[model samples]
Target: MSHADAGPDDDHPHEECGVIGVWNVADAAALTALGLHALQHRGQEATGIVTFDGARFHSHRGLGLVGDNFSDARVIARLPGTRAIGHNRYATTGETILRNVQPLFADFEFGGLAVGHNGNLTNAQALRRALVRRGCLFQSTTDSEVFIHLIAISLYSSITDRLIDALKQVSGAYSLVALSDQALYGVRDPLGVRPLILGRIGGGPGGWVLASETCALEIVGAEFVRDIEPGEIVVINDAGVHSIKPFSRQNSRFCVFEYIYFARPDSVMDGMAVYEARKRIGAELARESRVPADVIVPVPDSGVPAAMGYALESGIEFELGIIRNHYIGRTFIEPTDQIRNLGVKLKHSANRGVLAGKRVVLVDDSIVRGTTSRKIVEMVRAAGAAEVHMRISSPPTTHSCFYGIDTPERDQLLAAHHDLAQMTELIGADSLAFISLDGLYRALGKPGRDPASPAYCDACFTGSYPIALSDHDAAPERQLSLLASAP
Candidate 1:
């Protein structure tokens, strides 16, 4: 089922998109679909794939899961090509209409180019306004459409140069995969705020893969090559792969939340294993906030790894105090108000045998609006929990994300408005604790976050945005013009 149907208590920050591209592989569209299935966790609202054969380009986009859209053999057969690019969309920037489903393709003087982007642009609105003023008609409301318009109007001679020219005028975090007649292109934003990894389909001189995570590489039987460096672009063609660094080098501010929650546990990014990083974060949380309890209970799914780590570190027993139902679908009928109120139970149910008459420590990744946290806490208490202690693996998410994550506005965030005690009381917990920011860094193998130049983007916790929110700031009175330089 989709996130929208995951019950009323499904309150976690959402990743906006995931992108994958394949070059030199036979039935590349099918492989691209497999990679998208692996990245389905990143975004589930929509999926699309664009393929280029020797003759022409083909595309198929739908407003649902990748399997629902691409599992049919007929669909794959229709997209006959040796190169392909795909996108999984969750719609943080645009409506979930068919047009917004991406791998957005366009015809230009140079050739046809299909682009799949995995991050948000901070200045897209302003740029779109300028483009409209210059008589450029827009087809979609997505910020990603700005890239097409910019490239369409570029003064460069070659497609590569035109793309570089277009990138120079935008501000935001992005891991982009664009397919052209000449080659398959992958690019990461200057600050490296998102993830992009390179892989080889086989051994030496084989088909190449560019995806949002290493798990996608694994799913396609590809060998992990290396992470695409921030501010670098790689072009894959018949001859070989070529690299270009169009922007000045800068320290990366990769999104820290990816390790904490956004990425799949099996995935790896920036040389760190996501599952191991999460377990370490859990151990750090246990060390920082040790509370005596009979058992440690995870919120389930995302919280499972951290709970295991916390149990080991705290010397507490771990049990399946919460069981999740994987078969629940969006079409489940809520015939009455009572059934509607039981939505949380449709996806999650408290294991009374494990929780009854026990002091439970509920380990979860993070608390967003606290509605889900409250519901889960109440369910445990109702199951006869002696005392409920909540421990969060990450620091309080105090601010909204503007770089591809779907977070509530600042005011709606629970931590943004409440103190620890207030939050605990509101969530019906005996106590609550979150891992310190320094502890989180330590878990990631750092001494501590250097305020002068932090190792990762902890902007959601500190409200210190690494990239300027050009569009957000300009929305009030339109005081600033579009920023043409990378942040």
Candidate 2:
């Protein structure tokens, strides 16, 4: 099958986007690019940066990897500024077009402002219609543009007030990094469903940094100061970093999947080390589901850390049964069915020596559609494995995520439709199991998920949506009006 036909959620959920803002730092644009490189795994389709050189806003956006676009010194030089914000975009809303690429900049009644967002706005379509009716012309189809339009139409004077006004009208998860001539701003949604951290660039009264993850700060030589609290707005400028809580405090529902798969293994989020959490999850999984296995084999890369934890906890030997080809790009072309059938091998190859005559337990982060898992299992069987049992680090992803994660429709989700036995048969594994929700909570240092107010956003697993999906849940007539009003 063609890659397009395979769809975006073949096996794993895709990250929505990553944002970074740098203020009062030398070579700010270059540092932003480096931070983008660190966050490259979050989004690969497009990259952009907008800089305020104290005079005019300079922007350069490209439709490829950061290295492919921003590697040239000339490109960095073209974006000269002391304050800047950048984005790595894996489009969840608009089509992957140059115009949709961000740090989307706009000139308002006050001054030029640029914004990079890391979550989806559930009410974007509804808000867009109202804005359009009010004669607000949209330059791009991205939901991120909704903020720009709202800012432009705000009756408030200050940029911060205008932003607060725009935020009040919206509902959904978001972590934003905005740049203005006056200051660099970072704000998290009331739920704080996505991540945004504050950091210091140097010692004493040094510069400031804002990014989607702490790892970005490390790359730019910035020390992570603290996580931007839920419902908090942090304004960073020459004077110092200031905080504003525009929204009332609510229970934080940070995306739980970030620890399981979406985030880089090394990155820390919400004060939890992702790698350590994954290991703890694997340990929990081992305790909950122990099977007769000769060796533990990770699916590779994503599965490695958890597999190690499982091995340590279960007293099973860990082996690299599947070796991945890191050099393979997403755009690898397959001109013939013969080559296309070798799809899994193009990215992964079975280590025959490790799998031969062994009862192997395959540990993976999560299963989205079971397509990749089936293929990997088949490859292991072909390589002389006696048996293959699959274990997942996260619970069954039965519901689609509307926040910022790229998930298939509810109908396309494997766990949403099938029972455990059926899923095992479909994936051609001897047995299959996933960590329980409580087990996951334990791994994260929680006793168990309190149904009243869970510690994190486990919507994808429990179907307990934290935010109202306005666009998705609109009445048929309202949805029609939204479509009809589209430009």
lDDT of each: 0.90, 0.89
What digit string (tens of lDDT, one per residue) describes model 1 on residues 1-487?
Answer: 1233332446889888999999989889999999999999888889999999987999999998999999999999999998999999988787889988999999999889999999999999999999999999988889999999999999989999999999999999999999999999999999899999999995546599999999899889998989999999999998878999999989999999999998889989899999999889999999999998999999878898888889999999999999988877655735677766676778789999999999999999989999888988999999999999999999998888889999987768899889999999999999999999999999999998999999899888988889999887876443231121111
**Candidate 2 residue pairs in backbone clash:** none
Q: Which residue pairs clash in candidate 1?
A: none
Over 177-296, each residue of candidate 2 has an lDDT whose tens digit, in order, gives: 999989999999999999999888965475999999988988889998899999899988887998999887789999999999888888899999999999999999999999999999
* Model 2 segments more than 4 A misplaced: 1-10, 334-338, 477-487
lDDT of candidate 2 at residue 284, scale 0 to 100: 95
Worst 10 contiguous positions by lDDT, candidate 2: 1-10
